[model samples]
Target chain A: ELKVEQNPLFLSMQEGKNYTIYCNYSTTSDRLYWYRQDPGKSLESLFVLLSNGAVKQEGRLMASLDTKARLSTLHITAAVHDLSATYFCAVNTGGSNYKLTFGKGTLLTVNP
Target chain B: DAGITQSPRHKVTETGTPVTLRCHQTENHRYMYWYRQDPGHGLRLIHYSYGVKDTDKGEVSDGYSVSRSKTEDFLLTLESATSSQTSVYFCAISESSGAPHEQYFGPGTRLTVT
Candidate 1:
């Protein structure tokens, strides 16, 4: 069974501060994904890290993947109120079926 | 929004009642998945379909059933609704099983069992 673990499940940060959320998986997988969900809303795809050392950045959020370490990270640079949302990291076990195992997710609250 | 939609956005039902949720996609994706999200469990897949009429169970498949009669529709059925089964169900569609293609989620169906 594949297990994904994320650190700091609940995060509270002040505006203009920086923080990083970590995601670690148990199995060997090359594809990793990051998603964001606001309260009572659907999930939005943020990034797809296809291989080791792959990194993607959008606005104030950045995500990176290290397949060898079975780890992925979502880094927040200079947080803002708009960045307050629950972030999730998922791993796709390579195969024809393509199922994703997701982490518990980190709920971020940015104080202005 | 890959043209995905879930029916019965919010439903409140009594325990032991049979409930079915519908998921429709216009993107013509080959794969569809059903997942439930809870407070601490994140998103756990209940079932998935690789093609029309081809379905498989996921990590949390007990007490839940799914069927895909056509290419665009997937249905999730709860044989007997229970209070513990009350959750936010999400439907996702994917074009392929490779890189450069990611699953797109629907608006989700919030089911409450009383």
Candidate 2:
């Protein structure tokens, strides 16, 4: 079984602050993906980190992956209330067209 | 938007009843998937289709069955609804088959069994 662990399962921060959520997997993976979900809402794609030292940014959200460490981080810059949501990271192992294994998720709440 | 849609955004059913969830896509993508989301467990794949009439089981396929008759539509059926089957089901699609592709998801369906 592939295990994915995420840090700080729940986080609360004020607007204008910065924080990073971490995702670590048990074994090698083909790729990493980040997703955001608001309460009762569907998942919204945030980032797709494909390689070692891979980094991608969209607005205030930035994601980075370090395959050597089997770790990925989602950094939030200048957080806003609208950024409050549950964030999930998924990994697709390269073994024989494997399914996605997801983290437990980190629930972030940005206070205004 | 991937133009993926899941029918019956919210549903309530009784135990022992049968229910079917629909996932329709307009992107003409070759890959489609069904997943169930729950607290602490994240998203667990129920089934997936690579092409028309080609469906495969996922990790949580025990209580679920799936059929894909058309390229754009995938159906997931619960043979006998149970309380443990209550979850939020999501439909997703991907445009590529090589390696891992980013999956685009629909709004999701919330099923409650009482």
Candidate 3:
């Protein structure tokens, strides 16, 4: 079974501060995804990291994948109130099934 | 915004009643999936369909059943609603089982069992 673990499940940070959410997975897989969900809303895709050393950045959010270590990270460069949302990292178990195992998610609250 | 929509945006039902949630997609994706999200469990797949009439179980498929009669519709049925079955159900669609393709999620249906 593929397992995904995320750190600091609940994070409280001040606006303009920087933080990073870590996602570690068990088993070997190359496809990783980052998603963000606001309260009572659907998830929005943030980044898709396809290989080792692949990094994607949008606005203040940056996501990187290290397939050898079975780890992925979502880095927040400068937090803002609008960035307060729950972020999730998912791993695709490569095969014909293409099932995804997702981390529990990191709930971030940015305070001004 | 992948042209996927889940019906019954919010539903409140009594225990022991059967509830069916509908997921319709316009993207013509080859794979459709049903997932439930709870407080601490994140998102756990309930079922998935690879093609019309081709369905399979997921990690949490005990109380749920799914059917795909057409390429655009996937239905998730809760045989008997229970308090434990109450959660936000999300339907996702993917173009293929291949790598580097991301799944697109629907608006979600919030089901509450009383």
Candidate 4:
């Protein structure tokens, strides 16, 4: 069974601060994904890290993947109020590689 | 928004009652998935369909069943609703069962079994 774990399940950070959410997986996987969900809303795709050392950034958020270490990270640079939401990291593993096992998600609260 | 919609956005039912949730997509994607989100558990796949009449069980598919009779519609049925089944169900669609094709999600349906 492939398992994904994320750190700082609940985070409250002041605006303009920097923070990183970590995602660690148990098995080998070539693909990783980051998603964000607002309260009572659906998930919004943030980034897809396809290879080791692959990094993608959007606005103040950056995501990187290290497949060899079975780890991924979502870094928030200068967090803002708009960045307050729950972020999730998912991994694709096993034979089919179509199903994704997701982390418990890091609920970030950016306070001004 | 990926043109995906889940019916009965919120539903409450008693235990042992049969409940069915509908997921409809206009994107005509080749892959459709059903996932349930609970506090501290994130999202767990319940079932998925690759094509019409082709479906497969997911990690938490014990008391759930799925049917896909058309390209744009997928149905998830709970044989017997249980209190443990209460959670927010999300419907997702993807262009294909391959990497880089991110899954587009629906608004989700909240089901509460009493």
Candidate 5:
């Protein structure tokens, strides 16, 4: 069984601050993904990292992946109240179909 | 937002009752999946289907069953509902084409077993 772990399970940050969440997997993976979920809302895809050293950013959120280290990071820059939500990172190994093993999400709360 | 819909958005039922949730998609994607989310545990896949009449179990698939009689519809049935089975169920579809071809999720069905 593949295990995925995310650090800092709960985050409480003030606006205008930056923070980073880490995701580490146990074995080799074909790809990595980041998703955001708001209270009482469905998931929204944030990033899909295909290779090592792959980095992608959208607005205030940035995500990167390192295949060699089997780690991924989601960095929040200048977080706002709207950025407050649960963030999840999942892994797909060997790329068979789209089977993903997800880590427990990091619940982030940004206060104004 | 790929035209995925899950029926019975919310339900409250007693234990030992049978319930079936429906997922309908209009994108004609080849893969459809079911997942459950709970506190302290992120979305865990319950089952998935690659094609019509083709289905497989995921990491936590006990007490759950699925069927795909058509490409646009997938059904998840709980023969005997249990308290532990109460969770928000989600349906996702992934197309074969496109680069960022991640799973497009439905609004989800919230089931509560008392």
Candidate 6:
């Protein structure tokens, strides 16, 4: 079984502060995805890290993957109130089909 | 937003009653998936379809069933509703099950069983 663990499930940070949400998975797989969900809304894809050393950034959020370590990280730089949401990391077991195992998600609260 | 929609956005039912959730997509994607989101369980895949009449179970597929008669529609049915089955259900679509392709989610259907 593939297990995904995320730390600081509940995070409170101030605007302009920097924080990182970590996602660690068990087993060997190469695909990792970051998704954001607002309260009572559907999830939106944030980043997809396909290989080791893969990194992608958008706005104030950056995500990186280290396949060898079975770890991925979502770095938030200069957070804003709009960044308050639940972030999830999902991993795909190596296969031709799409079967994702997701973390419990980190609920981030950005205060002004 | 993707052209995916889930019917019965909010539903309240009693235990032992049969419940069915409908997912419709206009994107013509080749893959469709059903997932349930709980407070501590981020998202658990219940079932997925690769094509018409081609469905497979996921990690938490017990007591749940799915049918995909066409490419644009996927239906998830609960044989008998239970309190443990109450959760927010989401339908997702992807162009392909291959790597590097992201799945787009529907707005989700909130189901409650008493």
Every candidate's chain B TM-score? 0.97, 0.96, 0.97, 0.96, 0.96, 0.96
- Residues B7-100 of candidate 5 have per-residue lDDT tens digits of 9999999999999999999999988999999988999999999899999999989999999999999999999999999999999998866556
Q: Provide the DockQ value for model 2.
A: 0.65
Q: What is the interface RMSD of each candidate, in Å?
A: 0.7, 1.7, 0.8, 1.0, 1.0, 0.6
B61-93: candidate 6 lDDT, tens digit per residue: 999999999999999999999999999999999
- Candidate models: Cα lDDT each: 0.94, 0.91, 0.92, 0.92, 0.92, 0.94
Write candidate 1's Cα lDDT for B45-108 as tens digits. 9999999999999999999999999989999999999999999999999995456668899999
User: Measured with DockQ on alpha carbons, how good is candidate 5?
Assistant: 0.73
Return the DockQ of model 4. Answer: 0.82
Two-way lDDT contest, 1 vs 3, winner? 1
Worst 10 residues of 1 chain A by lDDT: A91-100
- Lowest-scoring 10 consecutive residues by lDDT in candidate 5 chain B? B96-105
Give per-residue CA lDDT, model 1, range A1-112, as digits (tens): 7899999899999999999999999998768899999999999999999889999999999999988899899999999999999999998863678789999999999999
For each candidate, what's the DockQ? 0.82, 0.65, 0.80, 0.82, 0.73, 0.89
Candidate 2, B3-98: lDDT as tens digits: 999999999999999999999999998888899999988898889887899888888899999999999899999999999999999999987556
TM-score of each: 0.97, 0.95, 0.97, 0.97, 0.97, 0.97
* Model 2 CAPRI quality: medium
* Model no. 1, DockQ: 0.82
Q: Which of the two, 2 or 6, has more lDDT? A: 6
**Candidate number achieving the greatest DockQ relative to the actual structure:** 6
Q: State the TM-score of candidate 4 restricted to chain B.
A: 0.96
Q: Which stretches of candidate 6 lie over 4 Å from their true place?
A: B97-99
